[model samples]
Target: MLYDEFNSYKNFVGADVFKNKATEKTDILKNLNPAFPVREYQKEALGRFYYYVEEYHQKQKPIHLMFNMATGSGKTLIMVANLLYFYQKGYRNFIFLLALATLSKIEGGGQI
Candidate 1:
């Protein structure tokens, strides 16, 4: 009975609804230009990230991203830009955990 109820609910929503939502969200994101103009290299990096994310989804695997970059290399800028991009694409909740030094620098308005 519970399984039948769940199936009925699924039927009402349709199996492809989530995929459609993801596609629509991605389309909207692609149309948006981030506040910070992305450099050529950054654009290439972002393209690769997007490609890997899509590939993971296609394989039905969970996506895990790690941005490994050197200090003084605009890592924070890239992170902020990506956050804004995702926020525009319907993401709302974000928890930014930073080290003590980094947090102090951000609080001091030294870095973003």
Candidate 2:
């Protein structure tokens, strides 16, 4: 999806959803059962990344983002959060491209 389209969609759908509201007193988090609680640092990093990607898309530039997360850190959780963010921004089709080894790792992990 292009950046302008994504931005327009974001505006149309309401940007408040993207904002992290779990910080305010609320039972929403407890009810939703998020995979892992999002840290303040993670939220800031995610917000920045989202802005950068949206800007790149608007400029019609190629987008390449890397998350140098440690193994114990919540890499999958971050990835899922990004996916959800884009989906909320009006993206429907998603193609996850992974290497053969990574695919193998997921398959093997599932079998374990």
Candidate 3:
């Protein structure tokens, strides 16, 4: 499965891959609204994503990744972090796919 492969790669790189790198980009997280605090898992997700992107960049490989998380697990926060990271990396455009339920939850002020 995809997660298994990711885990294998992560293992080869050691536990350092899980370190929270998002907080290091204070310029990005500093701009977030005070009402929304990013959780530890979200930071770890961003860290893993950054590690994956860097490794792929070094190999000149196409960058593509999927974040598998449970409902209401704060995936949107991770996406926002990624957008900020990419923008910092000089990217301008982005697109995100969300389920209708997720949209309603966000619109309804439910936890995302």
- Strongest candidate by TM-score: 3
The residue-by-residue lDDT of candidate 3 on 5-57, one tens digit each, is: 65787788775566645567788887665567888877778777776676544
**Relative to the unseen true structure, what is the Cα RMSD of model 3?**
3.6
Cα lDDT tens digits, model 1, 1-112, are 4234434644787754333433444543454344344454454345445444554244334545666667755556556656766776788998776665764665445444
- Alpha-carbon local distance difference test for all models: 0.52, 0.53, 0.71
Give the alpha carbon lDDT tens digit for every residue of 56-86 in model 2. 3444346666776666465554565666666
Model 1: lDDT equals 0.52
Query: Would you list the rank order by TM-score, best first?
Result: 3, 1, 2
**Clashing residue pairs found in predicted model 3:** none
TM-score (C-alpha, index-matched) for candidate 1: 0.50
Candidate 3 vs. true structure, TM-score: 0.71
- The C-alpha local distance difference test score for the whole of candidate 2 amounts to 0.53
- Candidate 1 clashing pairs, residues 3+ apart or interchain: none
Q: For model 3, what is the alpha-carbon lDDT of residue 41?
A: 78
Pairs that collide, model 2: 3-57, 3-58
